[model samples]
Target chain A: MNHPWTGPRLARVALLLAVAVFGPAAGPRSGFETMSPELRAMQQDDLANPGMLHVAEGEAQFQQQGCTACHSAEAMQGVAARYPAFDAARDGPIDLAGRIAQCREERQGRAPLPREGKEMLALSVFVAHQSRGLPLTPNPDPRMEFVRRQGEALFRERRGQLNLSCGQCHDDNAGRRLAGSLIPEGHANGYPLYRLEWQGLGSLQRRLRNCMVGVRSEPFAPGAAEYIALEAFLAERARGLVVETPAVRP
Target chain B: MARTLLRVPGTAQRGEVVEIRTLIQHPMETGFRPGADGTVQPRDIIRRFTCLYNNRPVFEADLHPAIAANPYLTFTFVARESGVLAFIWEGDNGFSQTETRALTVA
Candidate 1:
């Protein structure tokens, strides 16, 4: 008679058991928590935070575009927390940036803002700023399930010359040193943030693309479905983490 | 137009020291860096910042490319009287911005 349990299967079972017994090793930690005190102080101080400059620019752009005609900035509160939402027109998930572009094209009868452009970054940053301190609340639509699943698969799938997946570093080796910097859990709670490396405000997609480049992988185009899906999954993963739009990071 | 943020106390007691903070949006691109096209980027930075209270110079700074983008500065001055505080920043590429705030001393 053959034994049913193989060595690999037994190891997998043991790992699962350990996970179940101990729960996750740590609770979700924001990149903000991992930042140096100086950077943290920069993020906390509106006068010092460079991201506030983008927020100011965005506010002016919103008013110039007559966004106030439809709704006030206060009305946008909590909006950013529920992004990567299902779009009926696209029949897919759309991130906050995409929604803004769509509204510009359809609602305003104007050309959509260019991805990663100064205007777009400013607008998105401004919109996201309104949701600061609010917990991320990803859309719960059943339609989003498929997108979220795709995002999860892409996140775990190994690719690139480095032969590493996002989860391999962010999930399995978080808090470990990579080069001179600590590997963060890769949450998307604070986005359209100011990065000292970039010396400017950048969107979450830009950050993801940078990671792909670091791994020597071909990055998807801006506004790609893969990115939107990934953003949806990240929004879900980052649920309960407060939005820290325009956050400062080294 | 470049954006600037100014933080000056709206009110202070006479002879009390008050802090004034300012932040300006600028790339402050050092000439040493190469662009995406493999071309050397020209140096651009805020070269000077001046603060005047009641038309009298109170503080001044000469910035350089070594300074980071979005330059921020904070300084304190004794409150003397109700007056306007003017901030002026001059930089490369003919960049210049002026902002003013009113302060009241009781």
Candidate 2:
């Protein structure tokens, strides 16, 4: 029998290790992969996962608000993938939360929901859940070009007392350790995820707020244009990645 | 409003053991933590969780602040016949939620 780790095999193993260490680092992997085994198991098991609770509540609200009277739940599928979509009526881009708020005000004749509130988070989770496994593809209309540009600027611009840009931590130094936590690639594929830090489900805006606070910068309001733009920017960066809404994160 | 998720096998063979899992949404806040005002928040957590199968007690747990938010619990029971499993969780400030799942045996 031939020895597997001698001569040519030894050289191949050395080359593989070198590439693994010096590779481009960025990948389409979900932040869920960085979680502990117990946390991963909780997310894999729907019955044991808390995020599903929010999904359930969101489903209930969708019906209670009479949304089902016109739009079938099935029709809502793939709808979230197109979010942060350009709204000609508003003459600007809007995310899933923004679009839902619009429907509440114009169609349902109801007041807009408070941003990041339980109802809003639940509704977002419920809608995003339907798009699970579908690749995200933000709208690319001409009107949205400026907004995406602003989003890109916001992501790369340095701000706050710490003077750190999002790209520095999430894009350049991802997979590295910081404050005992692994800095993920900061993808928005998993919004409204159940975070151990929050001990509950939260929206992408909520996570952005946390980052803002971390950098010691004043957080933008829930529906602020800045957050909306940043969300769009993140969505564009995560394009082609499968939606992982209601995910569990440590 | 509280949301609950329950997992139970759709069918099981007689005399076989089956797994049951459940999770519920709750803050499970520990009073030791300070609030936005920097004041110590009062402890609030789920106090008890109980499961009944066929109207008979199957499992029970006394939870504390140490339990994570959205308390989760799992257990197994032998399959004897078709029946309903009831889960009840009671906590601080009169918080309570109940859910039921069906089990069938062949």
Candidate 3:
């Protein structure tokens, strides 16, 4: 594979695996067109009849739950294009789910959503589904400098009882699969997705929170700053990755 | 069938530069969905869509597989004149639908 970068774009897959691959210059084209050997071997068990039911449920939750009353699906047009956006107003970064929570409390005058709660997940999926295929646009506004810097650190810092950084897997072992799932070049393109493990729609923060739990890392509050920091980093990394929010992932 | 949902603020007035947003309901099949035998499903997607003003075309798109289910699109256009804003879509499975809404300009 041709790589214009300084080194291989992807490192070895596993702790002991010795396969090497390269290239971010041709990354996007290859990512969607050709499946990595690891991904090609994946089973097609989850692909089946249409599953619009979850989307419908999410739509209902979005309306009946009073989410649309504040966050304008219209005013917020192309909002998903810019995310992990540094909110100068809040003096921090706001992720997709975090924005939802902010509206729940600030505008709707309700309690903050539970990070892993059903309504929160459903709402996140519905909102994220609103924007798909739009190129990710990470805003590196100066006000977001602090949060973005923090996020980069979080990405590089080793954590979990495993003491592995996110970079180890996403940056280091992109295109490799762990267990059955391919190690996607970690990006924030697909925010809310129907994960096979969850068997339902969930947001990126939910996935991050799950990973934190798995690593035995002290979990942040649902809309914690640290998670937003990580979101900012991933959003920046995925600058060109299309926004496939509310995607179905197995 | 893709459901086209449109939203305009109450403040919208005639001759105003308005943001036109559309959300169409369709499976947006990536062709990855499986059949009983477990073979790669042929790609079936909403290949194209168009926006018309007073029977004249204003905007159109040729879509790809990566777009999500029930895809949403938005663009802004001037409304100096009022007419029926009609949306038509064509998909791989021979699916087609047209939606129209009235617009008033002063």
Better structure of 1 and 3 per lDDT? 1
| TM-score of chain A, cand. 2 | 0.88
For model 3, the stretches where C-alpha displacement exceeds 4 angstroms are A1-22, A25-51, A68-72, A179-181, A213-216, B1-106
TM-scores of the first chain across all predictions? 0.89, 0.88, 0.75
The model with the greater TM-score, 2 or 3, is: 2
- TM-scores for all candidates: the values are 0.91, 0.89, 0.56
What is the TM-score ranking, best to worst? 1, 2, 3
Compose the digit string of candidate 1's lDDT tens values, residues A1-250: 1111232346446545665677546356678767999998888778888998999999998998778889799898889999988999978788888888888899999977788899888989999999887778899899998999999999998979998999999999988999999999899988899999989999999999999999999999878999998998888887776788888888
Best DockQ among the predictions, by candidate number: 2
Span of 10 residues, lowest total lDDT, candidate 2 chain B:
B1-10
RMSD of 1: 9.7
DockQ values of all predictions: 0.70, 0.82, 0.03
Best by TM-score: 1
How far is A105's C-alpha from truth in model 1 (Å)?
Answer: 1.1
Candidate 1 TM-score versus the reference:
0.91
lDDT score, candidate 1: 0.87
